[model samples]
Target: MDKESNRDEGQAGPVLTRRGFLGVAAAATAATAGFAAGARAATPGKDAKGDGGVLEVAIIGAGLAGLTAARDLQRSGCDSFIVLEARNRVGGRTLNHDLGKGYFTEAGGQWIGPGQTAIADLARELGVGTFPNLWQGKMSMVSGGACARIESKGGFDTDPRLTHELEEMAKLVPSGAPWKSPRAAEFDAMSLGEWLAKKNIPPEEQIGWATGIALSGGTAPARLSLLHWLSMINSADNIYERLEAVKEGAQETRISGGSQILSIKMAQALGDKVRLNWPVLRIENWQDGPVAIHTPNGVIRARNVIVALSPPLCNQITFDPPLPPRRREMQRRWPSFAPARKTAHVYKKAFWRDKGLNGWIFQPKGPVLWAYDNSPEDASFGVINAFVNVSALPSDPKAAEVELSRIYAQALGDEALHPVAYYDHDWGKADRWTLTCISPMPPGFLTTYGEALHPPAGRLIWSGTETADIWAGYMDGAVRSGHKAALNALHAMNERRA
Candidate 1:
């Protein structure tokens, strides 16, 4: 085995943030310790590709990245590409669960800000449908069990300094380019909590919003670099302007049937090019020419390949000679943003709606971080998706359901409806990809490893929601990265023939 492949075979998960872990440990009721530690040892598997004519390119992970690459490749008139997906489904994070309540519920990514992100544009191009989430009634934030309606309230920030600090910090960030400012970059190096401390904000309010952001990033806030925060702010600012330009509200849109509609459309548009249930077990790059992908079914020899997976997974793919020291170091420095685990429950009704609530509860303590009213507008059953904050939940279906109910009651109210069925997939526990979200660097991470994250390594050009320049975490980001990778691949193909 090549060093790259051997490294992938012997690799471990991202290291946890020390201070961040301590903070969360203090408040987190459930823990995900030893989750990845127990993953099965790397097993060799057959390649899924057939002995058909040599493929010009193979795009792995048919989610948004692979699908976007396929669509763009088709547009560029490149017909010799194939999309391989591990799961039977196509949409990577744009997943929805049918809890048998009303309509489909989003288990992966469900929100669509008016960011005009590449995914949004692709949806429009593919004629995928969308609608505004009817986040009707009021939203509330709960801390220390105190409930206050958000709209008519000036909710207290435990520390007033952090609020001003973040706002002032926001001003230093240029309107269009967040990555350009050295001042901004400096703040990006520190943890959000550390930034608050620098601004003289107390720990209480800082931690509350810290919890909010950690939940938002699907990783703890303290572990997130301030740079990531600024990048996010810049993206949100772009989104804000687009919404204002279009006269839309922050109560934004979602896929009509679900985001997966876009995935389905992209896959269908690719015709026979998309291969489902084809998991890429190993990738080898030879110095002479061509890259080899090993799957369960057969080997696929391609002139080039787009990894289109999270960095954590990238670390899992073995390279023949080995990735450059800098790139390998970049992978080691950055951490995966995928959550430990998440659970979505299907309830019998939109029970929280009856109480004039949208079921958005921010808990400073507990396993449930955020819950949403995912009930499809036209469904009979009430479907809701909850982001389970911990990874230690047993794999048993019944146990997960019981734990979810307990979380709802504690975070929201005792009146929160009991779910009839539950659905969950642990992104972190998956051997291939542990992080549910994308890879995010610490404060200096982007400054130190930003360039390395984008460098096309081996035959492996990377793309995913995190690779996007504008909307890095959302589905839109995934589409952007795909378009980018396809362009690079197509250019290489043309140059090779030229």
Candidate 2:
């Protein structure tokens, strides 16, 4: 077992400011206390029920969305609820690769920036701190076998005029419902790649745009919907840089103690109300009150069921009476191809910083899509995290590590070859539950099946990061969806009593 610690000390580099230091200190203290208190709480039990042998609510998938909903229910003085997770772990998408000795590098959704108040507020409530992503020095752009150092404060060097055009187009699309946009048909008719091709963007400059969209949307621009991309930009306040860049962007700040800790802390507080390894195989009688949830363990009845899993994952659970045709078709067609692969290469120290490099590497023709310094706030050890092209890299972990190390050595110094440890997490192969890391909406997807995403199917209320109105496909969106789902459940329950 890896040892975990929340302490943040011995700051290095210009990564953390004075305010960041204080924030880290306070968060560490709060998190330490929270963990201790949670440990003292009652141990998690098998099941939970109300006086009527049925729960008021049953939340499926113990990810950020479901866990947040469970926490909200507890806060609202409601105990007739239980959280059922398919995996043995509580966190759904958010995971941490424990590096032992109180340090951890995030393996999944870890960043929260300006306008992402939902997750920011949740982190504060959970006593978690945050720090800015390291992007202080020159970034390396590697093509073919040559490497060029470029000055990029925001970690990207895309054309300013093109970004402005994208931002303008994004304003017409609503973050919640891209299909409702005035230019929905026109925008949805074309892919991002097509739009860029019309502009005759230079091949060199196109790499930046492609890398950004691929990292966020989980596919090449050729397959990504322009309307969906615009909606994502709208989520970042109709600012292309805010959506793509690290400085004042969606990938700006990282949560303390890893993003998964928020879900962990919430599950701890919920205790026995949270059930792990309880995959809901079927949901019966969902069209009426008192729905029956059939799991591997047993049948659990609930008045309201929060289907907090992603749209594609919902296809796994059999709806006894069948779901609405539109909703059913939406789930069946939901894009789940973006199961991204992330790797972390740990070193004795961040030697790249001394070479006037921020540890940011962008390879256009290589397996490394984007690699950046993911070292801890204190900089106790150097951790270079990257989103890699899975198909290009070796299948074996050790061989992949060696290939990546060689790539890093070319960009950074030869010191990259002497990494102490390497951690690789392929979301596609990690588990059956997570079909995709991010939902890369293809052209025409939103216009065809988006309306059915938010609406409730009988007693089952759809809730997940993808269901969020503002920051869908983000951690903030997951929390926002959770809040909405919990409120919906509470309102339905109250209406029944009335």
Candidate 3:
């Protein structure tokens, strides 16, 4: 959603009953009417003062999902809600790195592209400007320890034969109901490596594809599921080019003030209703109303809740009566691999562009898998970003810097050796609230347990990029999910009264 990779499988939920489904359909009208009337009070439990002492809603995680829900509720004249967040800041994956000189770059999620209209619309509404990604010039291509310059003609460097084959496979895996595909079980059973191995692509080409997979999915092909990968492709219009290419593809554009600003703006509108550092430790009484959310700041009771956090982070909160077996299993078996780190090498000028290079660098054997020109639009300063998984690299920052410097110099000559300033955020190391950068679904994880990704686990509704129906791992998908979760919470809560 934020990046072209469509990274993260951060969603999990359970199926609801027939009555619940009917209730959702029936309560939609009441929820809308309630919102239309004046409901703004900004306190969670005050709804119960006169009407049974039950708060209307309690949302967790002040990221895009939670913040979007809160903002929409505010707009709907519903203030009987509170957004509880564990971290001191907003924007889950979208973070900005101040690079000085009136230029700031995104350190986390911050990209918009073809068909990613949700985020684009949100940015436009929030008064955030957007710039197309610089994919115009010659890019440095590294393969088997050698580097060469290659130009982009709006086509991927991948083989047409390989790309076409994969694209055909993608058509079968619909974005909304990937599990319903006739070959779902077959694709779900195999890892990307096994599937590629069957295709018998040459080793060098395989290396290229592998790097793309890692950049696209935020994990290596060997660890990702063929089904999940195909589904992501489907989300991009069943075209492999839409998922991987720059022109008219997912890596098309970026927000001007960094993607995080969208959430920041949303939170600003909601005011203090968005509470930071209020990490929910436990959720009690979900089987009935007045669900108690225990946090370090104490407990807050609400009639409905939306856990708009990553599926794994959902596991961190102790559920009083425990989630359903399938939902629990979803969190238990979900793996957090390749926690990501992004580094922006800020320079005095765009030296790479002077050399006719667009600042796109792809390293096959890398701690920095994909490096590109992420310079500010003003071109006032140059910023080269390394979107990488530093799991196997050095732990120390200086040591890591030295290694990265060496790698950049090898690709961009001596000018790349030093930076005016280096801004990096290792979500892997720095943030406890964001445990995994993305969830690359492994073999059999979806089909065997895909049904758990929708429906509410009692009053605890689940949402995030990963749970999105269309662009499940992208920022657009995250926004779409937020809207959906808000509607679900509204509908379900109103259903109780009926």
Candidate 4:
């Protein structure tokens, strides 16, 4: 009969039995009160003399996946857990750049759209609002010192026939395991670029495909596996447009207060259970219960450990007894090269909108991959966010800002040159923790190592966006993975008790 119980009773999607709902609600209330009282006194590193020393669960990484799992555990009456974060703050890849006066621009994973129910449900639970991405009016395409403006209706103007072909192929490739597809061997043998070449796609259309694929897959089509791309399309319900377009697609909506707020809210609710600046350096005895997780300060022993980091990030931690060869090799070879560079240019107003422009600019042969209007919902000021080629831009922040301003001016007129402020974030150089922003699987990756992705390595349960069955490399996927990991941990704990 509590707030959570009432909310669950009224909730639409998945329904829980009355008894089950009450049990969760009652447990959550008790756990919250307990955590509130003992949070300040609880020291994860310190060993308590007896069986009380070992925690029931220890989560590695304070990102969405780890935090979500922690939240679920608390709700399930399991309070003997701790969340360890490497960075000084939470939110993981979803970061926000303060734009002053209650405005923020996302520097990391930002958007959520249709079919992303996991993240959407989490946002709703956290009281985070959402707004549609600005995609109205004309989009400017700049190439070889020439700029062309084309009217847009949300989606790109790529060839429909080609998209249909990709959609058909996606149907055969399961989003959860592309390697299990009937024709996975054939599809994984070639790159997307190779397949497109045989289709004889026009030069202009190819640019659209390339830009979309590179932004989503984190690499050019030439290096991206065809099967991998199809798996992504399968996540969007076997619709290529849904995976790539902004209208009714994966890029449809922006989270209110930026995507980072979701993690910030969850962390706040978790209280001191979420520990920052505590990176797990080494995990010992992970093959069995009572695992010892070593950090800079000390070590925390736990009955179960949830590793909620990216597959590549897993390589950073030293695992005693070593992980299985397949999982170890997968972690060793996982694609970690896509540390995307993003920038935000602040303007006094959305001037481009006044000229029937959507503030979208794509330069096929230039430094910018795609630029769009990331202005605040209230239109207090205009902000242009872009994903730029790091190699093409100047390394210095000041020089890079000017160079990008020049490019914006060429497309949106002289007013674009005089931005009030600018901010840049190169994920690769920004932090040692974040190696890659997105996973761009190569031609033979999934078929080779996909089997090892989901299985738990002893007491270490893998949970991250990459391990998600659908929408891998996305925020929604991260949330789903978190839920699965928490459930897995709960089941394992029950089995141990039995």
lDDT scores in order: 0.58, 0.81, 0.72, 0.81
Ranked by TM-score, the better of candidates 1 and 4 is 4
Q: What is the lDDT of residue 470 in candidate 1?
A: 66
TM-score of 1: 0.77
Q: Write the per-residue lDDT of candidate 2 for residues 1-498, one digit (tens) a residue.
A: 221212111110001000011113444435433322222222223358776788899999888999999999999999998888877676677776656555667777888888999989998998778888888889998877899998777846688898899989998999999999999999999999999989988877788888888888789999999999999999989888888878988889988777767887887778778777678899999999699998878888899999999999999999989999999999999998888888888888989998889999999887998899988888877889888888999867889888999999999989998788887777787778888878989999999998999989889999999999998999899999999999999999899999
Give lDDT tens digits, candidate 1, residues 346-406: 5566677777776665555655565556666653555555565555454565676676666
| Residue 2 accuracy (lDDT) in model 3 | 19
425 in model 2: Cα distance from truth in Å?
0.6
Residue 415 alpha-carbon offset, candidate 2, angstroms:
0.8
